[model samples]
Target: MLVDFSAPVAASPAEAEAAAVSAEQVGYDGFGAAETKHDVFTTLALVARATERITLQSGIAVAFARNPMTVAVLANDLQLISEGRFRLGLGSQVKPHIERRFAMPWSRPAARMEEFVAAIRAIWHAWATGERLLFRGEFYKHTLMTEFFDPGPNPHGNPPVELAAVGERMTAVAGRVADGLLVHPLTSVAYLTERILPTVREARGGGLDDFTLGLSAMV
Candidate 1:
């Protein structure tokens, strides 16, 4: 079953690792860590190194904050360390949050996210095959990769890339492109049965195995 090891809040890296270890010991299938004021990627890396059996996941790392290539590199490393138990959950926060708070560019979030996923997969393919990155998209363009920057080959395959989406457009995109879609806590059961599920099914042609539906609730 899916599980969230911790909420999206600020915490020391050590604490996050400890939490992941404890969750693994408790027999959780997957442990998710969220993003907030703290550094989610660093925490995820630490957790991957600390836990042995548990699958480590970033509930929703803000996509606009970093380039997709960097995320791919880090995710590949984390997957290697965790024995291929890394889930890269991506989310594009509000435009205002990206531009005003994170000081990052925000335009056409859905389109940017589409390009971002493509770029990440391209980078992973390049690293896996030892080929030069020549990805060109409307938003992202990768030209070269030197020895110093190239991560070489990944021991494990590329990590699973999930997307957290709430709106209809984002949900449709997630179903079409993302490995999985994380359902937010605010969504009700009715919404899932009627709205979200139908939209995702339409996008994915009703193939249940090709998509994963994640939900959060009070236990």
Candidate 2:
């Protein structure tokens, strides 16, 4: 499991660092950081650089805040910096927050998520294949790839892509494509097992193959 270190109640980097270190010392699988009005990636990258052994995850960095191309490059760079200990977790933040706060438009959340994931994969695929990128999606379109911009084949293999999701539609999407599932905390265990897992399982036509299960339990 992972611990969310970002909170309105805690403002100190030292506190977050201490919590991360302590979590590692106590044998936690990973520690997750969330992006808000405050910084998330830089802070978590620092934590990743500071710690050893324990995996560092993004709880769900807002996909709309930056382009999918940017996320692919940044996530790949951080994963490299952390020696492949980084997990890129993405989420489409709520409509109001995304549109009003960030001034980014909101499309169909599920459809946008699907396309965004596809775009990210395309970027990684371009990196791996050393081939020109030719991607066209409902939300994003990238037709060309240049030598200057492409990262070229990640030697460590692309870092795992974790999708933070809640609704049945989103869960089904994750099961069909995502490397991991970031479950909503508000869901009960029974709801997860019965409603959520079944959707995922049904999508996979049986069960997932080593697909990750991440539950957000309130402490």
Candidate 3:
């Protein structure tokens, strides 16, 4: 990773959608948006509708800011909107931002994130297979999914969940639960190749052929 001191401007939802349209026209493979100001899902939904071929992802939506059910529904909708090109990227933001800014609880982030992902998949399973939604865990509990609430198995199926992590514990959780790992920009190549990859591989108990890895390069 390299240090970048320049200030970058974030694109508005309309601007991001236009960029996606242009990127798709120019044959870009994927587009991702952060969740700093506007909701990432809102921006991605717009991009999903405006493009046809390019993949879309929520670069790192604050999982601590919202519950698993809401995140699940948002990801599912984005997948539907993108026609199977939506990848759900989630992050457990720091404690201050979670408590002071978002007014959400923050504790044992790694364990919480693992449970969050599990709860989402449980909900998705109930919808996809018409089974009872029974997910109970330490950080979250989701045992109800009425017929009206269930979107009923998304046509594109649920999107792949990617967890954003820089710490050892969270990175291991990503390997155990997430379909991909979103590496932090500050992570060096050595750290990624050594610490991150090893932790993930050990937790996964196999190769990395199917798992996706996304790294943000500073320009």
lDDT of each: 0.83, 0.79, 0.87
lDDT by residue (1-219, candidate 1, tens digit) is 455566435667777788778878887787787788677778888888877787888887888988987788778888888888888899998988899998999888888898899899988888878888899999999888887887777777788889988888888888888999988879988988888888888989987686677787656
Candidate 3, residues 42-110: lDDT per residue as tens digits?
Answer: 998888888888788888899999999999889988888889999898999899999999999999999
lDDT of 2 by residue, 1-219 (tens): 344443332334555566777778878778777775456677667777778888878777888877889888889987887788888888888998988888987988888888888898998998899877988988899888899888888877888888888898888888777888888768887988889889889978887787888776666
Best by lDDT: 3
Predicted structure 3: clash tally: 0
Model 1 pairs whose backbones collide: none
Question: How does each model score on TM-score?
Answer: 0.93, 0.91, 0.94
Query: Candidate 1: lDDT over CA atoms?
Result: 0.83
Q: Which of the two, 1 or 2, has more lDDT?
A: 1
Best by TM-score: 3
Better of 1 and 3 by lDDT: 3
For TM-score, candidate 1 versus 2, the one ahead is: 1
What number of backbone clashes does candidate 2 have, counting pairs of residues 3 or more apart or in separate chains?
0
RMSD of each: 1.7, 2.1, 3.4
